[model samples]
Target: MPSSDDVYSQLKDCVSEITKIPRGEITLNDSLSGDYGYKDGPSRRSFAISLERCFKKHGMTIPKKLDRDKMEEAKKLKNVRDIVFTAFGV
Candidate 1:
């Protein structure tokens, strides 16, 4: 498994590049729609596309059925560290 730090770094880099959100502005608590100005929510198709791109860039597989339910879980994530840890099944 990848280290938590590695995962966090990957997620931070992915989210920043995909969302076009500034590094300083990106935070775990920020909502995709409310905080990130993604009115459609973080689980929206567009966000998924960006996530898919990230996975592709890392030579990772795009998870299927990453819908609202999964997105909600993802949104509840507290930080890039959490996201990376969970994503790698750590």
Candidate 2:
């Protein structure tokens, strides 16, 4: 199994790609829209979906409840770190 840190790193990398947010610019205190230019809530939703696709590509699956909650709570994540920690449990 991958370590939590590894998972977090992967998530961060993939999220960066999906959100068009640069690595250094991503923080735990930034909202996807305000920080990453996500114009609407659906963009954040798509981010989560992209994350799930990434996870599935790696032969993993985020728990359904957690996935749903992650999708719902995307805007509340303080930064990239917060999202990674919450979703991947790092």
Candidate 3:
């Protein structure tokens, strides 16, 4: 498992890279879709997939992509905390 610090740090970096919103501005409350525009399709999938590499780089293991085909299941992950909690279970 990735240390909590690694998860947050890497997640901040990823959000910054994906949303172009600078890491300093990123917050746990920011909605992955509403704030970052990761609504569906390639964007969300890419983010999920990228997390796999990010966590791996930190020597942690999480599913490569929690790509939920069902909209209802997918909708549950709305923010940084949601994504990290669901993906890392920590």
Candidate 1 error regions (>4 Å)? 41-45, 60-68, 72-85
Model 1 lowest lDDT segment of ten? 75-84
Residue 32 lDDT in model 1? Answer: 61
Candidate 2, which ten residues in sequence have the lowest lDDT sum? 63-72
- For each candidate in turn, the TM-score is 0.63, 0.61, 0.59
Best by lDDT: 2
Clashes of each: 1, 4, 0
- Deviation from truth (RMSD, Å), model 3: 3.5
Instruction: Using lDDT, rank the candidates from best to worst.
Output: 2, 3, 1
The digit string of per-residue lDDT tens for model 1 on 1-90 reads: 556566656667777887687777666677666665555445445665676678668975433423544454444335434433555666
Cα deviation of 40, candidate 2, in Å: 4.4
lDDT of 2 at 31: 72
Query: Per-residue alpha-carbon lDDT of model 2 for 1-90, expressed as tens digits?
Result: 557667766666666767677877665566766666665657666666777787777666654424544555566444434555565555
Task: For each candidate in the order shown, give its overall lDDT on alpha carbons.
Answer: 0.58, 0.61, 0.61
lDDT of 2 at 6: 73
lDDT of 3: 0.61
> Model 3, range 1-90, lDDT digits (tens) per residue?
666677677777765665579888777666656776777766666766666666666666665455444322343233444566566766
